[model samples]
Target chain A: MGVAPRPPAGDEGLSALRRLLLQPEQRRIEELGERLDDPRLRARDVGRVLPEALRLSATESETGESLSEALAPTVETIIHDAVRRDGRRFADALYPVIGPAIRKAMAETLRQMLQSLNEVLEHSFSRQGLMWRLEAWRSGRPFAEVVLLHSLEFRVEQVFLIHRESGILLRHLSAPDVAFEDADLVSAMLTAIQDFMHDSFSSAGRQPLDGIQMGDLTLWVEQGPEAVIAGAIRGTPPEALRGVFRRALEAIHQTQAAALREFHGDPAAFETAEVQHILEGCLQARYRERPRRTSPLLIVLLLALLIGSGYWGFLVLREQQAFEAYRERLDRAPGIVVTQAVADGDGYRIEGLRDPLAVEPRSLLGDAPLPVERLRFRFEPYQALVPAFVLTRARRLLQPPPTVDLTLDGGVLRLRGSAPAAWVEEARRLALALPGVTALDDGALQDPARAELQSLRADLGRQVIHFGVDTPRGEIDTPSLTRLADDLRRLQALAQSLGLTPQVTLVGHSDASGTPARNRALSGQRAQWLRRQLLELGVDPALLAVRAAGSDEPASDAQTPQGRAKNRRVTLDVRLDGAGGETP
Target chain B: MRKKVCLLGAFAVGKTSLVERFVKSLFNARYQTSLGVKIDKKSLVIDDQPLELILWDLAGEDEFVSLRLPYLRGAAGLLLVVDGTRPETLDTALMLHEKALDEVGEVPFVLLINKADLAESWHIDPRDIDRLVARGWSVLETSAKTGHGVEEAFVTLGKEMLGAE
Candidate 1:
């Protein structure tokens, strides 16, 4: 590279050069550069110190008055631009923290609203609640407050005054009945929670923690500049009480600010009578009249309802048992088949198939009688081959004499009592032929003809024929002969009608004065003569038979004249084919 | 006196397990992530003073999500837990500690390296622990599984909260 010659340096030459180089504007520019070189002046450079300046301004603005007002437009513009650019990122960043918070807040608010609505509905519909509403209307108080008064039972179990800075317990007041330990610990915890809340969420103009809920208890807090007043309340308290707590805290702060601000660990200074009175005012225990302990009338009505229902159930059970027993009995009855048994109201509808010849169903209930009117029977006639039904049919078909009795043993039919021969024969045939009859027992049955024959024999025994002379050759008396002929004819007819051939015999008898042989000969002649007389009287010859007895059988005695006269006659004898003769 | 203490850590660092071991002396092998803040109370006596410690076991911080500030509002002390088997958990604990400091100011705290019973699988460097100790940070090796140092960590933080040490 080529080098140029250097100009001469002199004060006059330097002045001219300075004048030529430094115009008024150039001097101003140099002065400005020097000023810019100054640390204090360079501190104002937009690129070098603008960020720090802005940061300091931001911090100052935060501590200064109305930080939000000052930064609102800028912050809003930045937020709007960010949201426009990437709203999803912003939402995602906020979701985890804010989503649950919003959800919980909405849920809690809805739940509380629903609970209040339910309470209102429950109270408004209740009888005593109606009175409470009316009282609220009359007193011109809010319905919600009236409801709180009527239904809410609240107690300020304990009240604590805690130092804000040190978390020291300044004062504690509790209801006499409430027992708790570590009041100082509770106060410290409360203060710690408040402090935590302030530090964790250190945003501008953030409110202190207002309350903490644990099951049925709530810790209501009112934070003052120097102290925090907390009330542990059980059950829901009226909203107006929050104002009372606030007012109490304000009063304490106003009256004891110096003491509270200077308070160290000791709480003795706060235990003064005034502080005690102030804390005592926060302690409250009040119960709404325990909602009229279950009305006596309601209890009585419930008891009555229960008793009535029980009795009704018992009656139904008894009726069912009785009906079951009755149904069983009817089912067991012969020739009766129960189809259905239904209870209708107080009555039973019984449906069954029954043989008319069977025993009555009503009669079966003799031992355990049922109300006849309450039982309705729907029976269909059916032909049953049971023994009892068979017997009934047999009796109806045969219609034996009244003296005859019929009995059935298992499948066997037994006949007893006297009856006509024809009736007995017919009954035996019918009973044996009956559907269910396995056998017929006619052993006890009697033929009426036999009885008639016995009576005829007795009449014959009382009758006697008399001869005028004692000799067998003597003629019979006309009147006596006529009576003998009539008697013989009647005996022949009676025996023949009884399906038996009868033989009429005339026996010859004499007193003890005659020889046995002569008596026997005379008896033979008399029997032959009587046979001929009977033959002449239209009596069948085959029906007549002679028996000669030489006084071997005497009707009475042969010694007395009257007895001899009764014995010295030719006796009449009547014998059936299967019956032996009886001499008279 | 009652003190509200918060347990802060990354996920699966045994913060809840530590609280369980300290409060109930019980430990379970199963891991269950807490979704939100869980509050538990333990009564203890330290230095002849009865104190009720209300433990706030907060859900572990997820990379995509931050903790709710309200949950740590009333805390008087903090327990920063790290899983010894995971060295990255120490960084997470340090980050949470920074957040706690910013939100709650200076409060009593203890740094717990959890799962000491599993020292064979320890990943936390002793140098990192020494650095914390050199920085005057309270550090303890704890095991929620074997209940080692869990009570001590809580008691130490409790004592500090009560200004006893």
Candidate 2:
């Protein structure tokens, strides 16, 4: 230090540290530059830092050079870079090649594992006594060439082989593509190889790349498709070998970028550039062609069809509206019109009156006159709400029989009525008839007895008889009612029941009371009473026509009490009376 | 129609021998384990309809007692085999029946006292076989070696398998 004022440790120290920490190579170059500038300083620096293991010994050489002199700069730079800039730039420049190399190494490892699995399966299958060789073996026929390839994007690279012609002793060598370093490319290549060769073992003859042969070679290999390039060679031809390499290289290049872009998200410069040009070309070509179409005939035909369908639909809709309107008018207008009402010597008679109010207003308002469709009317005898089996021939023994809305408790049926005297006998019979009905209490309306029967007879054919009976006692004692119910059960069992059938009528009668003002009301009550009693018996009330003639036209003298009693009783009088009036 | 029922057993326990006797009324000296399950179908007139009875015959393996369990599913009836001469084969037959019960649940079964032509030297007692019958198992004594009782085993199975009263 005293002899030389040794250069500032600051610059020297920094350079040495930089060499050790960052670019050691650059640091070594700098050290070399310093030594060339001054020989004495370079020799002193080498002597201070040289390790004992690298120390110059007395070992002689023809052109002797010290070990420290030879590696001294390199050591100096390594120390200097430890203090200089970080070395990421150098690493960045090296990565593209390194990354692919690593990926390729990993894919090769995986391919080897898959090949081992296939070998194991083949050995197992052959040992199972299932597979038999189908082709004959000639004395010198080359063994079948089994080439296992690692693939990428349908591009294959040979990775393994087994040859039958070479016997079991021929040594096989592996020559992997050094440039192929993509894992995704390898996977695609494998898939394509498997798909191509799955059923290859079963082929009968050799084709290009389908089989292998001896020195008079019949080796089939896929070389860029068309030039199957089938040829015999005594040994491997240099040109043929070169051609194989070229085709394989092309396949590798094709699948490499494609598989990378597809699987690893790598973009190709050429692909990006050509894509837009191809798209523009397609668009320009399409514009020049301008797809020629049919004359306006298609549009005209379409419009015609649409309009025709619409017109047909409109006609259907209008017809449907007309039918719906006709139905509405029919429902709104009563089927029969009453034109006149007259009270004559026989009874109060009425005439049919047709009114225009019932017609739809739309028809009247429309400009054109529409034809009216006439209505057809039919009358059928009314059917009972309840079946006949529950009643049977049990109406004769009732005492204070049940009436409408009566509640039964135990053996007692309760009736609440204020009907006239003509209806009393009929009411009594009805109350006694129903099964489970033993007694009755009249609490509501009473039946019209003998007093008002005459007016009821006049309106009988006009108003339908709708009758109902109550079983208030809740228990039946009558034999006929039990027998009827039994018969109904048997009919259900034997399929003998009348299902939804219509029947004829049996008209029943009751006498009338005097005094015209009260007679009409009393007569209506008597007819209602008889209808209820008939319903209580097995005879369906729907199949019965009951009418009352009040004492206005009594069957016997009203002055005698015995005549009133006979007239007040219910009597059966059958009739076939289906007319254009009320349905009974 | 001929109602076919298979007799399955261990090697030399007379499965093929029994089938030969039943089909042809003759003894078969040679025997082999069936390679795979075989099917035989026969028809029986029930309520005037020709009802088909299909029987599946399985190969005999040492592990067959275990493998036959899954094949017993949907089987109408089973005919288990035991060698009357050697008592050990009876255990294999019992194992098969128990496995069928475990997998198929109480299917109707018949046990065969097979090779009855050699029954004079048989070691298994009659009382043990009776115990099985008492527990609702059907027992039939057959001689596949002599064609004795082979027809009766199948005819009895045919009558019982169809629910024919």
Q: What is the interface RMSD of each candidate, in Å?
A: 7.1, 27.1
Whole-model lDDT values for every prediction? 0.74, 0.44
Off by over 4 Å in 2: A1-584, B1-6, B21-34, B42-51, B63-68
TM-score (chain B only), all candidates: 0.89, 0.75
DockQ of predictions, in order shown:
0.02, 0.01
| Per-residue alpha-carbon lDDT of candidate 1 for residues A177-275, written as tens digits (9 for 90 to 100) | 566766754565566566566766668558878998998789899888888889999898788889889878977986677887765334667868878
- Prediction 2 TM-score vs. true: 0.21
Q: What fnat does each of the candidate structures reach? A: 0.00, 0.00
Model 2 C-alpha RMSD vs. true structure (Å) is: 35.5
Q: Report lDDT (Cα) of residue A80, candidate 1.
A: 94
TM-score of each: 0.35, 0.21
**Residues A163-229 of candidate 2: C-alpha lDDT, one tens digit per residue:** 1110010111112332222222222222222223432432744332433456332233333321111
Which numbered prediction scores highest in DockQ against the true structure? 1
What would the DockQ be for model 1?
0.02
- Cα error, residue A417 of model 1, in Å, equals 99
